[model samples]
Target: MAELARIQPSLWFDSDAREAMEYYVSVFPNSHIGSITEYPADSDEKHLSGMAGKILNGQFTLNGVDFVCIDGGPYFTFTEAISFVVLAKDQAELDDYWAKLSHVPEAEQCGWCKDRFGLSWQIIPENMGDLTRTPEQLQVVLGQKKIVIAELEAAGAGI
Candidate 1:
């Protein structure tokens, strides 16, 4: 028997669950699509909703973290309050994610940006949590879109 993840984040989409899942898998390596269920055309909810044969629910993994996406109609949308934080191992990794993921320039601040799918993401350096010990170091990163590791280190040392 296969073990299941205890908790997984389910993303609600209007009608693009499959597309989003595929896109995510393509972006992150070592990820693949899991189970997928589609709405039946003859179901009672089909005619009124017009979502027949669309993805009812689907699962995928990003960097080993499981996630689910549902074609749940447009009653709700993604918010910035909930975001995925990508821990970049180096400046190259940080730059790659920032360029590939961020789509809304106006929404970017303090290493946070909204992707084309409206999902919020924080592209942060892997050592950031350790570097921001002092209030001064924290302040240095408050207004920057992409974190500069050298600057953060200097700030932490009061240089």
Candidate 2:
């Protein structure tokens, strides 16, 4: 809990919370896993014991945020309202991520997409995000639909 706030944000997803959490561990740098709870016998095997009720809590830290995944059901699913942004620092990084992340257009928004588990993410260059914080820079980000790494660099250098 003490270190959770240092980096990243925790997100909750119902069906694939567990699998997604583990996958994230492999995808990011300086990342490790944390505690998890299993479903009790009383519940259906299809439903991991603790997976029912008001909130199914699974605490996973990715890039160091106490990313709490909850099986809260379909009442809430991830949307553009909240998205995980991945900062790719270079063209190789961007292309690799774009290819892998945009495999499904149903879950893509320029450089943002949801994985098989319905977890939303933004795969953008790291420097792009840093530069896009200003008024003019922010426009560069919004001007395009998808994240073009070249454009990002151009935007960063104000070219």
Candidate 3:
């Protein structure tokens, strides 16, 4: 068995854990679906009655980070309070991630976007701090959905 990550972020899905896992692996490089444990068809527990064949625990890797997800019914959901950060090395990388992940237009703000799976992601440049050194640059960033590094640079240069 492969060694697991010391701390993996687990996602709770209503009934699309498998689909979400597959979608995520497709979005990021160096990603793949791992072990998947399904709920028993004959489960007697009331909470798991209709969960036959549903994912109990689905492990996956995305961009070298380990994560787990489950088809845990509609008792819980994803919130913007907890978001994953994708620090891109450059504008092209950032644009690619934003293009692929930004599905909920209403949820986008300040380089943060919500994916189709309802998960929030902050896709920003790795040197965001440096780019937004000035208040003007910071304001420019806050006004855009996607992080345009060149715009920030222009703002910082008083262009």
Candidate 4:
């Protein structure tokens, strides 16, 4: 099998590649927008009118993880199948991420939320694996939208 270049995730946007990159960089620590490629005004691409001077591609780093966003227009959209998991160190971190990342209230489930750009994310606790060592603990995790560390601990302890 061919090797992957660190498996950077690329997000497709209708015309908000730069916006998405900036938003992500603002939300995550140690993140930055690397480079941006704009579509040429004279390009013969199919969607010339909307593509001209738009961000064709944008490179960004979120919490040190590299990602890309493409302003490919409305041909494609994001789904829940693929998502980024923010492993928070504590409830405070999780709450911060949850506030910044959660935009679609209906999409909030089991610590997963869809942002304004329709991208799904899992803002989970770092100690989740250690706590969810049993079926009950796992159920506790599945029962809520935001993962509360205290609740997980309580459930794990059969409290």
TM-score of 2: 0.66
- On residues 39-70, what C-alpha lDDT tens digit does candidate 2 reach at each position? 44456664455554333556766665567665
Per-residue lDDT of 3-55 in model 4, one digit per residue for the tens? 86578888899988888888989998899999998988755665577587778
Stretches of candidate 2 above 4 Å error? 1-10, 43-55, 129-146, 151-159
Clashing pairs counted in every model: 0, 5, 0, 0
Off-target runs (Cα >4 Å) in candidate 1 are 1-5, 42-48
lDDT of each: 0.87, 0.64, 0.94, 0.88
Q: Model 3 — TM-score against the truth?
A: 0.93
Better model by lDDT: candidate 1 vs candidate 3: 3
- Per-model C-alpha RMSD: 2.9, 5.1, 3.2, 2.3
Q: What would you estimate as the lDDT of candidate 1?
A: 0.87
Which candidate gets the maximum TM-score versus the true structure?
3
Candidate 1 minimal-lDDT segment of 10 residues = 40-49
Model 3: which ten-residue window has the lowest total lDDT? 40-49
- Lowest-scoring 10 consecutive residues by lDDT in candidate 2? 46-55
Over 56-79, each residue of candidate 1 has an lDDT whose tens digit, in order, gives 889899989999888888888999
What TM-score should be assigned to candidate 4?
A: 0.91
